[model samples]
Target: MDVSDILAAQAEKHKAIAVEKEIPLDVDAGFLAVTDPNPIEKESYDENVEEYLQSTARDGVQVLLSALFSLPTTSSPDGPLAQLPPPTTTLPRAKPLPKPKPPTKWEKFARAKGIQKTRKDKKEWDEEKQEWVNRWGWKGKNKEEETQWLSEVPANADVDYDPTKKARDERKARVAKNERQHLQNLARAQASGAERKQRKADIDRTLATTRVSTASMGKYDKKLDGEKKLREVKRKFEPTEVSADVEKKNNLALLAKIGNVPAKRSKHEGNDAAINVRKAVRFASKGEGGVALARRAEGKAARGKAGRRK
Candidate 1:
């Protein structure tokens, strides 16, 4: 059945039981009396009646069950009640937060000056010392102020004030600064060495390339010189005299065909004989002793042939 139907049936049964017993069912008062160990009395009956009703309305079936199964209460002054174990449930493991780094000298100074303090209604500056003064008189104000306070011995101060902590902080800062400079110098030396090595490598590569190029050019120049020498030797040893004789004969044959000469002259005839023949031909053509010159030439030829036969 539906929950509401079940609840209604149960209420009806309770009402019927109450009626059958002929007892007034002060449900709220009964619930409250069962729940509360020490119930307060009301002045008016109506007010008490309203309180009991409210208690019953606030609880429901839970109140009825507790009332029905309640054990008899007995006071024992010697011992406490037995405690129930807490409920167990699965839970995630929480990661631990990182520990905060120790504050530096500057940070400590700022904190002492109350620069890191939370803002509040009362904030005042001491004009004479140019510092902030807290009304609460908290220890951290500034290094100078803290020092001043430390100088003045207080009767009830628990913690001892010493300048050793500040001295140690200064020493740490100096050491850190020196270490940083040393590392920077080491890095600079390494970088300079690397640059020098690269430059040397580049120069070597250029020199090697130039050497190879020069060698190749030299080989080409040697090949050209050899070819030029061969050409020169061939020209110097060529048959120049035979060629010149053949050229001269060709020129003479061309001149004879053009009728610029009377006949083929003796190969032994000198320049003076050729010049006299030219002058005799010029005198014969002009009809001056031309027949006499022809007769003299025939006589001289006959005498030369007779001498050669003898």
Candidate 2:
């Protein structure tokens, strides 16, 4: 029997995978993005939602895999690895671009005069040392005159005048000037109407504090012109000749306010009995109170004597 028909059937069964759609799938291997632009068939989707979705996803994945395999690959120990090209798709930035900083006075001046800023080399060539030495910092060329064995002094300079000290002082002055200018620029940049008003208020408050910080608390100090009168805090007290009834009420209110005094409940309050239980108890104990009655019932009359002996 001929097996050509069976072989042909088997060949048709196991063929290369191919997915066809109205629109092609856009695959960005660089970003690992696979977008399916083809519209879903309503009849197929309505028949089975889950299967339709899975089929659409499978087709997209198959297209992405095919695109990936088509790319050139480099051989490695493990296997061949394909290098993805730069992505063509332009994605939006997650965060907005940062705002430019406010220009400093020097920067503004440079821009105005069309002066291009240039960076100076940190290292400089030394003729004597025959090597590149730092222009500044850590035994730099700027400090060479101060550290040198011999230094030339001015002809008219005093006998006590030191050339090394002079050079060091000049360098320090330049550093101090630069720092002062930096602070000035910062202050200028940060200055505003609101800031000026706040600064003025701060100055006034400081001045007021200083005025009261004198030996006599500014009482004996001579007042300056245009100085506002400081507000004096006066303490008021109740009259010594207050009515007895009013004073008693005031004392009771103060005691209540401090939680020192408890409310006096009515005789029937919290007691369902017709007779006042408290009064009956007091009468039965002969004004000695419940403590005396309890001691008498417990037969502890000799408690005081025992306690005293102990």
Candidate 3:
């Protein structure tokens, strides 16, 4: 064959082979198409809710009526209508219930923020000593024992010295004694307020000039020095009787608001149902009874038959 004719024949053979290997896809069944134009009507939620409520009410009423009528009452020969004993009534509570405990962990967290129960259960207050004393444990016995290791050991005091050195040492001792005496006088003497201020200023200036440093790296901080005893003493004491007086007034007001309130049966929202009882009873008459109700009704029918035979 010619080259063009051969190429056309090869192409036809490849097309037949491709047809044999072709895969049929079910794309419409697998996924939503990009252009779906069908509109859906929204369901009415109010109608659904009403239907649900109606169904629930109808079912409950059916159950209740079935329970009431199917329960066997003891028949007396004296009367056809047997009177059921009334349910016992409960007495009204004189006092309200105690408040429930806190529900949230936040309340517990707040109470535990910095406070813990006092750890003074085993300790007692010694009013005479103005201190708390540990009562449950034996105290340590502190006996006075003199340590005598250095009693027989003598220090070297007699070194041969020059008279000039002795005189210099005596003069130095006298100067120190005079300086201590002057400081003691300054402490003991009562000074005017202005003099005290001047002395404090002089001391500060001297300390600044000398560049004196303290052993500790601590600085004066008011925050570190919390609520001290000085502040507690400064606070004025108010009598707590005013709170009791206010509580009494509140009690009186509450009593006045609730004047002559007669006791009544507890009111419930379900009692305000407007459904037809006749329809519910009709539905219930068609419905099957529970095992207990069926047995009770059978027993009642059997009893009636025996009484009729007698």
Name the best candidate (by TM-score). 2
On residues 1-310, what C-alpha lDDT tens digit does candidate 2 reach at each position? Answer: 9999999888776543587778878999888789998777999999999999998888888888888899999999999999998997899999999976668889999999999989999999999999999999997999998998988788999989998999999999999999999998888767844878899999988988888998899999898898898766789999999999999999999987975533454423655468977888899899999988887867765876788899
Candidate 2 regions with alpha-carbon error over 4 angstroms: 1-16, 71-79, 119-134, 137-141, 156-162, 192-310
Query: How do the predictions measure up, each by TM-score?
Result: 0.14, 0.51, 0.15
For each candidate, what is the lDDT? 0.56, 0.86, 0.50
Model 1 lDDT vs. the true structure?
A: 0.56
Instruction: Order the candidates by TM-score, highest first.
Output: 2, 3, 1
Q: Candidate 3: global Cα-lDDT?
A: 0.50
lDDT string, candidate 3, 1-310, tens digits: 4599889999997664331212321112112111222232235435586775564445444443433455456667874443433433344789999876422343456587955545546666667557766663443111001212222222653566444455457656867987886665555443434788899989876654433233332233233344222212367666666698788887899987875343342222223359754456546555443554567678999999999999
Candidate 3 C-alpha error for residue 246, in Å? 18
Candidate that would win on lDDT: 2
The reply for model 1, stretches above 4 Å from the true place, is 1-162, 194-310
Report how far residue 86 has shifted in candidate 3, in Å: 99
lDDT of 1 by residue, 68-138 (tens): 44534444696433332232333465987786654544456788887765566444576866877754335
Q: Which 10-residue window in model 3 sums to the lowest lDDT? A: 140-149
